[model samples]
Target: MLKHPDTTNAATSKLAATFASQQQAARAQPYPDYRSRLHALTQLEQQFKQQLNALAAALSEDFGHRCAEESLRIELLPTLQGLAYQQRKLKRWMKPEKRHTSWLFQPASNFIQYQPKGVVGIMVPWNYPVFLTLGPLMAALAAGNRVMLKLSEDTPATNQCLQHLLAAVFPDEQVAVFSGDAKQAADFAALPFDHLLFTGSTAVGRKVMQAAAANLTPVTLELGGKSPAIIAADANLAVSAERLIFGKCANAGQTCVAPDYLWVDAQIEPALIHAMKGAFTRLYPASRLQQDYSWLCTERQRLRMRTLLQQAEQAGATIISCAEHSWQHYLNDGSGLLPLQLVLNLPEDHALWQQEIFGPILPIRSFSTIEHIFTELSTQARPLALYVFSDDKALQQRFLKHSHSGGVCLNDCLMQVAQDDLPFGGIGASGIGAYHGKEGFHTFSHAKAVHSKGWWHPGKLIYPPYNKNWLNTALRWLLRR
Candidate 1:
């Protein structure tokens, strides 16, 4: 989507100016010292802490009524944790890693130095705006890169709050925030950035990649797909249902890594669904979903979920609403309070099964045997996250080795991305590259090789134009392998 020509021109001009200014700043301080980086991270951390209440309130307002406490717990906490982690480990991460020189290159030293990639561009999505913005921001800042963030326009209130907080903590050159319409965001992506990272749906991710390709800018895409969960024949029904429900219901299942569907043993489908529905009711009683639970961030998303459900129903799928009241009663009331819904007997050609369901909907497909699950999964595009529930370690190992996903949880869901030490991303269509913790620092930096050779000059032996003896000897020794 784009705006009028005049709007596009204005947005392009503004973004170009910002990029130029940031480029200048990056040149002035190509690499910040460890102490300077730590201090800057500390400053941002303090500002984030001070504005926690406001940020949470802004998230609530932007989503029409998100639980402020939930915002703090889910968004503010992770952002702060990542900042502190980077601050503590920045010095060590900045040091050069010594590499072993081959015997042929004796008296030479080889090492890798992580250098800043100059100005970086980060595109934030509406869900978990604060955390997503800061997660990569910390990595870029830790690696000493100037950053420009294009926050989602769907989240105006949270974007305003982030703009104020970022402005108070860092200068426009060191860190810039852009909250604009789709046209401006499109223009921002097209800018020639040193590196670009986008977090959104696969369809939009492709467009972002296309725009970045114009500048030859490398991208780290964190996209969502049909992340599925498997319930093994021997799995614990109660624990699996509890964990799966939590993963699917969190943020009303708007999370990129949330479980999109479940492949369960046909014999246990009824029991598993019953346990999940009960667990959800306990988490957010059907009677009080409007008072306690989060709604979809926008009405458009709400409508999409509704349409998907209607489409599935039209195709003769059996629908099971988790709450006492149907999803429509809560989600359709202007507020997007949707409850967990289970779809069974859905046709393979149904739209719900074909795409990522970024709402509180789970399609339950029954598998007769473990092999049956693997056979079907092997034919589909790799998903972002995979969940398996079983006590059998060998079965777990089999899934681990056979399936390819961005991340996997042996007996749980959504826990893989929660850790700061882990690299979070997808593969294939799900995404391109990952960035979190150590991986993130390198993502925004270049691993420049620093090789040094002493004055010993051992290579003088092979300098002659005609050195038959040396050539034969070297070839004999080298070609022995």
Candidate 2:
């Protein structure tokens, strides 16, 4: 159903008014004390505990059969851990950071006070809805900022559940959640927030930034790109295959940081493929029908995956389906289920190679040398995450030094984002700014510089007197290398 233009404008105006109210409230308190922030976080955690099962079920229904266990493991656990980490570290993070002053300014002391950035706007994506929504919310709250969350319309069930959970603990003036269609999301992005954070496609991120630009709002975009996993020649094929399968198959590869493709040494390509097939078979004995496997969130996503596979196959790419069950059954059942597909030797200009494949399709390519891998990656924009499977520390370090990415996982995959202590974000097309741990606190904060001077200042010598005497000599000496 198409929404009326007048209705859309009215909704936008309503959201803006709410934002203004939140901003006013934030100004009244300005900086929330440690105790207040801790209390808010504790309330959030308690609410989650009470509604954990409901949240899991809501998320499952939204995803057309997302495993409740997967939702709890991937979404709820990480969010709870993030909340605990913030509660434990908020006091220390709020302390003023003392900075050393130069000898020339000995009488003055300098420090940075972290202040909240008024009202913050967060745009949540459908994939990992709970984790993404609450993860950033935790950081914003820890930094003592009022929050306005725009939940994804695709996950209506989860959105309603989240709205109820948040309302139980916080008033609209402190935290608000909006649920609507794309028009509402666009209006939400256009809001003049003190700090705005969005998680979604690179294309939408550009639009969000453009909208926020009119307000001069600082934005932290958590976007997705074609993240790649590089398998070293010396790495154990079995181990790499196991980890890669887990990372890629989790959530049916709808993750933004999921391995979009694999770069393997030409010699190990066959062995790695064999290992991956074995890994997938063991992981999902019934293939797409396995209870552990999550369906694509919607029919559109399933069709998009199918189109990518068909395009790759028609363009002379080798298509390998790792389905131990009948594919026709899944299609006839209308389960939105898709088998893990490996596309090999795809053309450089193929659509699957160009776009971020946010589904259960994994494109595998072989490279002869490390330089070749670097050369290939150099042509693309920085990815949100990069995975390297290698036993050699030197090789891993070299790759780390040469390659650019938001985060890198060595000898494993996807676990880098699970660490609450580490900052998770991307570079270039992948994302802008970071949010997690202390970095997250800083992102949602303004580090105001404070300079304290004693009553007896050292500037008496350099007062407004028009004389080039001892002070001038001292200045010249100080300026000298």
Candidate 3:
């Protein structure tokens, strides 16, 4: 249900007051020392550990039947690890970086101070709610910034759990959580935050950017598109299928970085399909009935997937189900379950081929040559991730050099995002800016460059003296560039 405009306006006004308070707090202590930052991170980590089971249960309740084990593995573990990584490195990251000055500026020095951007606004997504909410919050806190998180309306259960967890450790001025409907989200986006981070679909990301632009707020959008998995001619079919299927099947292919489609050599198409089927059966013999298999988060998402599948089937595309039983069996029970399907030979104009499939439907296309793969991908927006499976270094290098994506994972899938040292984000339409590890710290920080000079410096020689021979020489040298 949508929120009333008056209620949304009241919430927005209260949020504005909190933002102002935090801004004032930041002014009082512009930079938090390493000890204080570490303490905050430590408190968050302890609270997360305490609420692990509750969080998993809340997530399961929100998603109808999300596996607690999958939640622990995917969302909880990574967040804890990220916090630890930040804690261990906060001291070094907090130190100002020394920079070199040109020879002409001898006795002068330059350095960069990483200062926190005050009052960061984090807009969370329904899928992987805990991870997305806490992930950006970790970065913002690590950079010594206050945070205001707007929780997703679709995950009310999880939001309540998270709200309790946050309320126990921090004051409202430090970290606040807001929960509301779509109208509230629009109002929240309109706030003049120092920085805003949103994670969701490409269509909505555009609107978020527009709202942020009104206040000239810097934004980091983690949007999703149709990321692809390519199989080289010389690749191992079984290995490629296993890794790709794992990523596509996790969370029932609701992951933003999940392989949306596949491009394989024509000769190995049959072999890859057979391998993938075997892998799926071995992993989950009951398919959607398996304990760890997650259902589509909402009924609307389920209907969207069904419509896309029906459209493809009507367009003369072959649909191959990976389930051991009929898909209707699960659907009849009102489980919102969907089978992992391999869609073959979808027409270019088909919705299955055009839209980002956020379900367990993999569109497989055959490519005779590498050039053909490049041509097909060139027509679409830049994807957030690209997966390549090949043992040949030359082929891998060729694909890496020819294509553009936010991140590339070779011989695997979705594991690059787990690496704390690397930056996770998108390029063109996939997303804007990145955050993870030091990149995340810098993303939420302002890199202010400071230049210091001594009184006995060479700058006096070049200060508005047109008649002096030394000044003329200095000007000529400086202008030589």
Candidate 4:
């Protein structure tokens, strides 16, 4: 059961005290040098590796029946790769980057010093808790900042496991974790911090930003939108269906980047639908669907997804459920498990088409021409990820140039985020900032520009009153360039 967050003085005081201690610790160590930062990251990596199996098990327990293998592959693998990538590049990233100096300031030095932003707050969503939490947490630590994390109330088991793992490895002043209901989450967001990063729905993301605004804290929001999959006319049906099925079905479509709706060429819509059904059935056969697949996290969430499907059907949408007994079987069962439900002909005003369908429900739309996609995309909120499947290089390049998204995957799905070097984030309605690799390091650091002069007073000459003829001549000559 969820309760409103306790906003009484006691709760607020506790949170504020935690923030104060972290701020104090940050002041004590001001800037952790390269060696210290590297050591901190190494400690994090080793601790995470030691607790890897336990983390997977806890995640499974939280989801009722999340596949342990899937948790290891999707949640654990990329996070380890990210940590190693940071370790390999931390040394050079920490160095002061040399910048060009103007002719007026020649014989002097100019560079930027990457300074830690003191303390950072990270808010994790229920889905992929480990990846989302550690991804940003590692970046903040690597940038040499103390961090406080607020785990989702939705996953108590995983949160407890992860909180213990972090506590065992790091002291409170270095890394801390907080847990509470949504209202409590709001209180956490209102705290004063050097930087705050949140990963969740766009609706909650807005509230987080508004709370952080009181402190004028900078934030990085990884919010979700209805990411779309565009299948070009030249795309191979078998290949496209296979790739999309895995992306949408993995995590049972709870992923923020999962394809919410697909736009296929009208001519091949039937053929592609057949291919998608075949692909889904082959991947998750009815006999083993419950055993191998993950259930919706909670009964509440499961019913919300069901309500979306029911409302769509009420509004005259066609549903093609793939699995044992189809989607109808779960309506009365205590289990929140739902198989892949492909919806079509849903009314334009239905909520299924309006909101981010973060479940195993995918709405398929057929487009007569590729250009029509741009017209629709232009009006809707910009998504965090976009999938364009096309064998034709010309059409592929067209999406790359015309569409706007946080990231684009060519001929693939969800693999874009696996690249440790790419900066992952969204724009416009999708999200505010990015974090991954070098961009991640910089996001948690303040780049302070430094200009040094070696006893040369040439700049002083132009600082005086502009009455002298020589000064006027010099200014005129400089302005000409």
Candidate 5:
């Protein structure tokens, strides 16, 4: 059962003690214990499927009218797919990788073994709670490490559901979940786990990294920033607008990797904006409010977006609110959904242009050429993802070569994250390590190099001989080789 205490001090002590006990137990256990742990995780694969469905339902209720299709696509599918992929690939991933030895070390054999890093702490974000939690949890479990998950306080229903589900299937000493306000999260971060993984905003990621540093704990930060979408002059306007708009508005533009702004070739800026407005109008018609758009997940985010929009207007930006069609009846009962919007012809210095706008509002800017767009993006902090829509292969290659971002989608946006086979991560500020496929497994595993050697291959040529002749001979032989 989940524990609750009247006093904050008592609760903190209790939770800290529980976490400490788990860490100690995992460390003190024998090799066989690791085997059992792996076996339990294997069993959890089947059990978690049903739990995921229930958890998704809980999450949908929490978000208030989040489409089941979107939840399944984003959350359930990714987790189950990760579990299945790991189950089939882990044995191969565990095999010691042998390396060829140099002629000088002929008698020695070298291999790199994958070892567990012990307990791992996962701090899951609220936007995609299930996948964010399971993504890291799976990696930790696959590498034979125990896990302690801290769910976002913003997602209370999802957090409670995850806590209940995990408690049912595993002992507290194996895996546990904790949830509370931001202060509680700060306390959780202070605990020294073998490794800590955090997925959230860039600002919060810094705090997490600093806290983990106090205990010398290794960290993998998956943070988000202002990812830009570049639409070239020669691109297919309809296809480009369709895909980019779909990605931007899919989660009501709340995604970290969502295209933050558009850098359109100046020649096509007018046409692209028209296409975007048309695409949004078709999906979220004013006639069908509930069926068309999803609500902003939290009131704080809504207020933030509202403030940004207001700021952009004050700065003389053109706010082209998409004409609402006919989806009004569904939203009559107080849904927080807003019409998809485009902020066009904004000056570079506008407040909305300065930060990551995590809403349906897309700020459109015009660039004269590819080089100019590249220079503009290069000046900003590396974004989580960059979308370059172009038919010219040469232009695409050139842009990629000069740009530095977390990930890129050629002629598209956001879909690159779905290609499970590829490694996904940020370079500098966006994030540290890649996860997904074998990369995820390796990220959570400790690879140790081992070398086996015997006395049979003794070097008699230079065995501490105090002679000039021996030294000369050795030097001559090394130079000749």
Candidate 6:
């Protein structure tokens, strides 16, 4: 059934109305004591966890799969993990950073203070909506700011569930959820947030950035691209193949970090493909829809995948489908389904080769040398992630040095983003600012430098500026020191 656009817009506004009211009240209160505001965080922590669990459960029912397990293992777990790590480090993160004072001002002090941007706007993506919202929300609240969350319209059921969950724990003034279609999402972006965070496709990210620019709001954009994986001739083919498959198939290839293309040493291309084929067959044996292999989220997504695969095939790429029963199950149910395909010998001109295939299809493009591969990659937009598999330490180091990407995996794949300790974000076209762990805390906060100096510190130094003797002595002393 087609969703009424007005319904989505109304739901979004209804949620945002509370935060709007709070913003008005806050202006009247003018810096309401943050100790009480800070104290609420303790209760928020427990309630948030429970809400996440419930939302995960609801998301599972809505998606009609083992979504609860996937949500817990993937989304909710990572969010809670970030919250726990931040909670442990918040005090230290909040500690004032000291700086050196000039020798002339002997008794003065200088330090930098981190302060919150009044209200933060978080525009979340449908994929992992729970984690995307929770992760940024944690950062905003930690910095002592109110948050307005714009949930994705792609996952309406999940957004509705999130609305209820957040409302149960927080009022509209402190935290609120906006559930809306594209227009309302755009309006939410234009709402004069002190800072805006958006996670989605590169095209949409540009629109969001432009919208935020209207208000001069600083933005953190997490966008997607065709991330590449290079399999060197010297690589351990078996290990590289296994890791690549895991990264590609995890989340059914919905992840931005999933390897979008493969650059194989021409001499080893056939062997690498064979190894990957075996890995896929072994991991997801063709007998279950509720297994390692999952269906594309919607029929539209499935059709898009089919179109890309067909385009690749027409361009003379050899396609090999992963033998998954999920395809057969969908076929039996009279539903559209696209197989997890592996394309071999794809030309650079094909859409599958040129664009980021955000589905289960993986394309292989051969390269004779690292320079040739890098030359090709350099022409494309910088990827969110790059995976290079090389046993030669020197080659690996050189690859890392030469490539500009959001993140890199030395001999593995997408697991780098899983490490909460490391900052995750894209560079150039892939994304804007980073977030995760301390990086996230820093992304949402602004540093204001503070200095304490006596009023009597510096009248004589500049009062007689025209004196050459004084200027010479001052310059000589400073320069010598």
Candidate 4 lDDT, 334-356, residue by residue in tens: 78678889899978898988899
Better of 2 and 4 by lDDT: 2
Compose the digit string of candidate 1's lDDT tens values, residues 265-349. Answer: 8999889989998888887885667766788899899889999988988899998998887766765676677888999999999
Reference-based TM-score of each model: 0.97, 0.97, 0.97, 0.97, 0.92, 0.90
Alpha-carbon lDDT, every model? 0.90, 0.90, 0.90, 0.90, 0.79, 0.77
**Clash-forming residue pairs, model 5:** 286-325, 286-326, 286-327, 287-326, 287-327, 288-326, 288-327, 289-327
**Which pairs of residues have clashing backbones in candidate 6?**
none
lDDT of 5 by residue, 417-469 (tens): 77667777887789888888788778877888998888876455556655769
Candidate 6 TM-score over all chains jointly: 0.90
lDDT score of model 3? 0.90
Compute the lDDT for candidate 4. Answer: 0.90
Pairs that collide in candidate 1 are: none
What would the per-residue lDDT of candidate 3 be over residues 1-481, giving only the tens digit for each residue? 5567787788878878888888888888888888888999999999999999999999999888898989998889999999999999999999999999998788899999999998899999998899999999999999999999999988999999999999999998899999887877898899999999999999999999999999999999999899999998899888888898889988889899999999999989999999999888877777335587888998888888878877888999988988865554555668867768999988988887778999899999999888888887787799999999999998889778988899999999999999999999999999999999999999999999999998799876657746899778867887997
Q: Model 6, which residues run further than 4 Å from truth?
A: 1-19, 25-44, 51-53, 61-67, 324-339, 458-460, 476-481
Model 2 deviation from native, Cα RMSD in Å: 1.4
Q: What does each candidate score in C-alpha RMSD?
A: 1.6, 1.4, 1.5, 1.7, 3.1, 3.0
Q: In candidate 2, which residue ranges exceed 4 Å CA deviation?
A: 4-10, 287-289, 326-329
lDDT of 2 at 292: 82
For candidate 3, the 10 contiguous residues with the lowest summed lDDT are 324-333
Instruction: Give residue 350's lDDT in candidate 5 (0 to 100).
Output: 81
